[model samples]
Target: MRFEIQFSGHENIRSNHQKTIEITKESHLTPQGDCIVGVNASASCADLPRELKDKLKNSDSKITFSISVENYEFIIKGNGHQDLILTHEEDIVIRKSDFICPRTLAVKCDKASDLLPREMVELLRNPNTKGVFSITID
Candidate 1:
């Protein structure tokens, strides 16, 4: 499977509707189990002093990570690190007895996507795909 990371546009409230964004390769990730890969995108949010808090409140400059498995394509939101878009592709070994077509599959990430400011549940349900994508909160 191949994975690619891309950044897309969104509202930067702090910039007063300005489309200011920066893309860089400084992502880092720690892996778990035999399937999961975790990524850390930014170094600090500490510089957001009170004076700039409101302006940067809801701005998210997210990079898109896409994975192609078999004939299915799955996408997750994150940022890039070193030009490598991070992702975890697992080989889910299914036994004949438990091989029913599952409608959803729960996935756990090192960090948490539960409180992340976007909705992507529907994307995991593409007909071409075989499983559901879930963000387990830690």
Candidate 2:
């Protein structure tokens, strides 16, 4: 399925409009019995919390996110790190090549009932977290 993910935040953080990703049951399933959906794009360093930006520059840090879809909710936690590729643009693009920086949480649930690929993207777009940018679906 295909879905568009948008990021919104304050002026300091450059928010990305709509980014798209495709998910499939066969491709997303992991050996640990989890479904993994990820998108890699860059966001402006300024968009990140001052502490988080500093931490990424110096070392890796754990970032947590809460995702909810209809009646299902799950938490995805992953390490955030600095991207080596510096961009001339102002926004930070979470690239598929990089596994860190705003990656979605690996969801653990009954895939058949809890979430579809499109629903997974919807959950990420509307996460229940503060300070971090809000996401919208389109």
Candidate 3:
């Protein structure tokens, strides 16, 4: 199963968090939101399809998450958990800490925002940059 969320870059996209990466439906970002890579997200946890939501609740389900912008792309491997709420209305988060919450999309992620390539992070500092967030599971 797969789906994609569209988003745009922001001026405050520092992409410097060590344990999590997030996308939010809010169009504005503050400097303290270092983990948020994209703003004006096209979707959120509450917007996920029922099929994908089911898969994300299964402990055995694995997810491949990707963030692509211009010519740069980063991939993260993660897993679902029974504890996932997947109901946050505004945000979706990929976590490296195995934590599950309403905003958590997938846990045990291989990379957080801080691990992204600096070049890619640089491009994301432009508010006009377009980006895609994709999730796939088999």
lDDT of each: 0.23, 0.31, 0.94
Model 3 misplaced regions, further than 4 Å: none
- Models ranked on TM-score: 3, 2, 1
Off by over 4 Å in 2: 1-43, 67-74, 82-117, 120-138
Compared to the true structure, candidate 1 yields what TM-score? 0.20
Model 3 C-alpha lDDT versus the unseen true structure: 0.94
Output the number of the lDDT-best candidate: 3
Cα misplacement distance, residue 96 of candidate 3 (Å):
0.6
Could you tell me which 10 consecutive residues in candidate 2 have the lowest summed lDDT? 8-17
What is candidate 3's lDDT per residue for 69-128, written digit by digit as tens? 999999999999989999999999999998878999999988999998988888888989
What clash count goes with each model? 3, 13, 0
What are the per-residue Cα lDDT tens digits for candidate 1 across 1-138?
A: 122232212221111111111112223212212122111212112322333223222223233333333344444443212222112131211111211122111111112222222222232223232222221111
| Candidate 1 Cα errors over 4 Å, as ranges | 1-34, 37-60, 79-138
What is the per-residue lDDT of model 2 for residues 1-138, given as tens digits with 9 covering 90 to 100? 112233321112111222312122121223232222322222433344444445443324544343344464444343344443322223333222334333321111112213334443444443231122222211
